[model samples]
Target chain A: TQLLEQSPQFLSIQEGENLTVYCNSSSVFSSLQWYRQEPGEGPVLLVTVVTGGEVKKLKRLTFQFGDARKDSSLHITAAQPGDTGLYLCAGPFTGGGNKLTFGTGTQLKVEL
Target chain B: DAGITQSPRHKVTETGTPVTLRCHQTENHRYMYWYRQDPGHGLRLIHYSYGVKDTDKGEVSDGYSVSRSKTEDFLLTLESATSSQTSVYFCAIRGIGDQPQHFGDGTRLSIL
Candidate 1:
């Protein structure tokens, strides 16, 4: 079973549009990470949030960890075609010794 | 990709056959992991190693085995390939501290 769940399994939008993807979980996590994966390439780490209610920004992308540490969100401002790819959220498996459990992915397509 | 490299970028095999994927890292990271990505499932951990000759199973360890005989190499073995096991596999490594994990390009495997 997947410990984390992502909404909007697939998304398509025009460039300059804003969007947000969410990752939710019932169990609390010590840390949460977001990654972006392009076709034929492995997922690359984008950001990591360690504290609850913490928010981090990378370029036009903003990431927020839920206050309870059980959820997270990624918001992209003025999306571009280059932002098209799969977005995945992952959290360390509690008591699993650094093992990470990934969420169902969100495939985003940005059109020009 | 990062310093990590996964061998056999692409492979085709028949069911019941055996296959092995290699992951080599040059950064000398102590923690290494193997994960498989599929539609909707995002990335699922297969196995991981914390040190030489020390390995552990992940959420989807069935039909998959792993080894870490050295600090720079980790091997994933599929004793018997199955159609369900066909997917893009990724190898990742994390160094000591709060640094995020780095991923390899990944190996695309097909089981007929």
Candidate 2:
């Protein structure tokens, strides 16, 4: 069973559009991370939110952690074709060494 | 891809055959993990290694075995390949037991 659930399994949008992806879970996590994976490449870490109610930004990407650390969200402001890829949200093991339980990935396609 | 590397970038094998995937890291990370990615299911943890000769099973450990004989290497084995086991496998390395992980390019395996 997947601990984290992502909304809109697949998405297609034009460039400059704003989009948001959600990652929800019932269990509290020590930390949650967002990663983007391109074809034939492994996932590249985007951001990690360790504290509840924390927000981080990277270029045009914004990430927020839930107040209870049970959920997280990734919002891309003005999406671009380069942003097209699989976005995965993962949570580290609650009690152990960095073993992550990943969410049911969100596939995004941005058209230029 | 990070300092971690997964060999046999692509493989096609017949059912019931045995296969092994290697994950090598140059960063000497203490924690290493193996995960499989499939459509809709996202990436699920199959196994992980915390130290030399210390490995543990994850939620999806059935039929998959792992080993860590050294700090720089982790191996995953499929005793008998099956159609259901066809997926892209990824290797991850982390500096500590609870930090963000770096991943390799992944191995695409096909079971016919």
TM-score of chain A of each: 0.97, 0.96
DockQ of each: 0.90, 0.93
Poorest lDDT segment (10 consecutive residues) of candidate 1 chain A: A91-100
Write model 2 residue lDDT over B31-112, tens digit each, in one string.
8899999999888889988899999888889999998888999999999999999999999898864557888999999999
Docking class of 2: high
Listed in order, each prediction's TM-score against the native is 0.97, 0.96
lDDT of 2 at A52: 95
Once fitted onto the true fold, the runs of candidate 2 whose alpha carbons sit more than 4 angstroms away are none
Ten-residue segment with the worst summed lDDT in candidate 2 chain B? B94-103
Task: Name the lDDT value of residue A57 in candidate 2.
Answer: 96
Question: Which one wins on TM-score?
Answer: 1
RMSD after Cα superposition, model 2 = 1.3
Decoy 1 TM-score against native:
0.97
